[model samples]
Structure formats: structure tokens, C-alpha cells
Target: MDERVTVLKKQIRAVVVAGGTDEITYQSEWLGYLPFPVDHWVEYQGKTFSGDFPFDWTLDDLASLERTGFLEKLEAYENPEDRFDRCIRYRVHIGCA
Candidate 1:
């Protein structure tokens, strides 16, 4: 198994439970995004916010999360026009609003 992924997953869990703020930018503004899919996804004001990980995605980490699940929702760019574009990533919405 991937140890780094495992470790990172644990760290992310801690961050989610602590209740804090973190900003994740994809093609648009998504606030309170949870890297895990079990989290709730909501839209507030003019931006989108994802609460806690949903039951299905709660146990998944970067490597373990389903590649096709919600991943397809992400915007993808070839040759990445920007820095955030080139890297394979997921957004985590932290804290409670």
C-alpha cells in the first residue's frame, strides 16, 4: 500500500474534525471542501461549500478515493494553463459554517 497516502489521509481526517478554514481553488471558488466524498456539498452566497465527507467517501484518502466517483466533477486542463492545473489534486472543505 501507499504509506504516504495513508499518512496524508490521517492528517486530513484530523484537519476535518478540528473545524477550521481552508481555501481550495479549482476553476471556480469552492469553500469548505472536503477531500473526502462523504462530505456534504452545498452552495452558499455565491460560492460552493462541501461539509463533511459522505458515508461512502469517508474512509477514502487521496489514493483510495474512487477515481471516477466525484473526481469527474473536477475541471481538467491539458498542459495546464496555470500551476494548479497541472497537478493532480482534490479540494478539501474544512470547518463548519
Candidate 2:
């Protein structure tokens, strides 16, 4: 067996011995699932935010969205922490594999 796998097994055993549940109901993914359909078009801060799913936020009016909390809850697929945070809604990058 691989060294990393052995180390992981030991860690799992430690957790289990400490009364921690090894059965993870929630597994972290590259993207998060959204319940609602994403709008193709959005008008914000006098700017037209239009595109497909997984819009490029870097080209958006981030200042306004940050102030208005429009996309505050949304996170990129490359960002794994926000997806597991559970404190806010996270959007998936639809185009990514």
C-alpha cells in the first residue's frame, strides 16, 4: 500500500477512536449545487452582468456586488473552502469538468 494511504488510514483510525464519525455525509467538491436556476442576465450597479452559468466574476462590478451582497454568497469552483463553509450559498462552475 502507498505511504499516503497508510497515513490516511492511521488518521481515520485516530478519529474513529476519538469518537469522531468517519462517515462523512458531506464530501467536499470542486463545485457546489444551487437549488435555483441561474439567471442569464443581471443588471447591477448600472452595469449589465450577462453571460452563461459560471459567469466570470473577475469582469463584474465586484465593488457594487460586495456592497449589495449580490454575489457575496457565490464562490468559484476552484475555491473549495467556501463550498464547505455552509455559512453562505455557493455557485458551481457549470462549464468546468
Best by TM-score: 1
lDDT (Cα atoms) of all candidates against the true structure: 0.36, 0.30
Clashing pairs in 1: 32-93, 33-92, 33-93, 34-93, 38-53, 38-54, 39-52, 39-53, 39-54
Best by lDDT: 1
Whole-structure CA lDDT of model 1 = 0.36
Tens-place lDDT digits, model 2, residues 14-75: 43345432221111232345764322233222233233213343223332333433223343
Candidate 1 lDDT tens digits, 16-79: 4554433222232223347732222222222443344332432234335324232222433434
After TM-score superposition, what is the CA distance of residue 32 in candidate 2 from its true location, in Å? 8.2
Could you tell me how far off, in angstroms, the CA of residue 25 lies in candidate 1 after the best superposition?
A: 6.1
Worst 10 residues of 2 by lDDT: 88-97
In model 2, the clashing pairs are none
Clash totals in order: 9, 0
